[model samples]
Target: MVRQETDVTLRRCTECRGYAYGGGPACAVCRDLVDGLVEGAWAVFLRQWDTVAGGDQERALAEMVAAEPDRHDWRIVDAAFDRLVCPDCGGRLARGPVGCPACDLAHGFRYAAIETDRPGVPPGNEHAIRVNVSVVRRPQVTSESEVLVRRLLLPLLLAGFLPTTEAAQRMSALMKKSPPGRRAQLVEQAVEGLAEEFSRTRRAARAAASSPTSPDTPAATRHRSARGRPR
Candidate 1:
């Protein structure tokens, strides 16, 4: 007796309506966002591990993992809207058109359609902890070192080591001055400097956290006191 073969249907992503590969339920973009979120969260966790009090570490880790999805979504939205402008009024698309009603309506429609799919972690501490633990245990390499250096750049900038304009200027100058062969070395050294600065900022933060708080401490400072060791 001959057996009939059955055709299997691939799942389509709800957001993009594309075939979902790798046995995943979502399209590549959505699936990759989940990976990025996990990796980003792990990077943040490693950097800020020393900032959390020993007793509160578990809770802090969970909260940090939970926050990654929203952060990822907002980053996507911000990038999508960046420098987008109204054609008629030439106003920023994010702010909407000032005088052009047609542009304003179009901007509203486009803004409403902007993708902000927040890929999330699996429920429960076990999954997050297990995945991150595996991440930490993975073997390191030169490329990973460079990636870590690159990852620290934004955090360093946000922590205010140097103005963004100056940093960009210096980077441009370095690229112009260095030969192609030496450029990678020089760039790596520069990023390492930024990483060191970030480390110093984290150290200061840890010191502040350990010190007794004053009633007169500014609310802003107190707020930042809660936020790292850079690797």
Candidate 2:
């Protein structure tokens, strides 16, 4: 499940002037680093899972399941972001790009101003890279249970409901809970529920985006009536 924080307040980072979660530094750089490590680890873990058998395979899987939450812990990245600084200008990078010329050149001048609820690159290049790497590194699925989990989780994963590692972790948990006799039916019901939720979220987002702005009040109007008689 996606994690949630309560009663959070955003504050501008001292260096970048962009809002950070709980008023901490912008976490883009830290998020990038952590995501890279997690994706690389997943690639290795999944590949190993494909190669091993019996007790060895079970042990590896157990290790992965146990480590999954820590692998995606925000505290780790948040702490790292607090300490990290731009190498070129020695400025904090927690909200986004600092005024370092090199950093601006690398990330774009407007990087800090790009408002987003999620961390990392605004264009999703980081996510794309991770997905590509996972595809290239992980072996094709051979187990029926693995295949079922992937089918159940792929849509949500692609839709950004969760990260790849979390999806894999959830897949393992779900497979453990499902019995072969009713797995197909249970999976179908879960998929339908997820699809409905995704659709509702999409509709709400679209409605918000398309909602009309408030009408201009006369006091705020800048244009004046034409002078004299209409020409």
Candidate 3:
């Protein structure tokens, strides 16, 4: 079953700004920030998905999974054949589960008798739902420069380049590490260079797509032949 990843109220690591489920453990980004792993309480936990499994798209696919639901008709049909005896002669009960085939006698209907069991909780804690933890792996962030690159990811995403109020916190960290002028220069340099490369790549792709291929039709051959003839 495709279900939404456990994405409710996630907390952020103060040092790296990476997300985490609780306050106890240092998240992947901030290995030095905290000490102990936080024990979680019993709650409804959605299965965690890896990148290939489509991180958050599981929720959307869940709707597609249950698109067709099962339905059963409530009406019932019954017939008796074991007790089907000849109404006129009162002799043959040859019919098994249907009507008397030879006599054409109406034997009436037979229904399954249903008795409801008294509802009570089953004995055993084994039947109870088990509590499980959704382990969120840490982001494999290495350096501050990498973090800066990550910070610029949102603006660069649509440009087909390097793949946000939360962005303010990250920006604050970057600004603290470098002088204002240097920080601005660094960001401008990175973003502008990436933009130029992305534009060049996009233009090349468009050119390739739009370029006409060699025509294989007889008409193309004739045209080629015509062109080959000197004026």
Specify the highest-lDDT model's number: 2
Candidate 2 per-residue lDDT, tens place, 85-134, comes to 45676653232333555434423321222112233122443343333222
| Local accuracy of candidate 1 as per-residue lDDT tens digits, 139-162 | 131243333223323223223233
TM-score: which is higher, 1 or 3?
Answer: 1
RMSD of each candidate relative to the true structure: 21.6, 20.7, 28.6
Which stretches of candidate 3 lie above 4 Å from their native place? Answer: 1-147, 163-181, 214-226, 229-231
Measured by C-alpha RMSD in angstroms, how accurate is candidate 1?
A: 21.6
Name the TM-score of candidate 3: 0.26
TM-score of candidate 2 to 2 decimals: 0.31
Candidate 3 has an lDDT of 0.30
For candidate 1, the lDDT comes to 0.39
lDDT of 2 at 217: 34
Model 2: lDDT equals 0.40
Model 1: colliding residue pairs: none
Give the worst 10-residue stretch by lDDT in candidate 3: 125-134
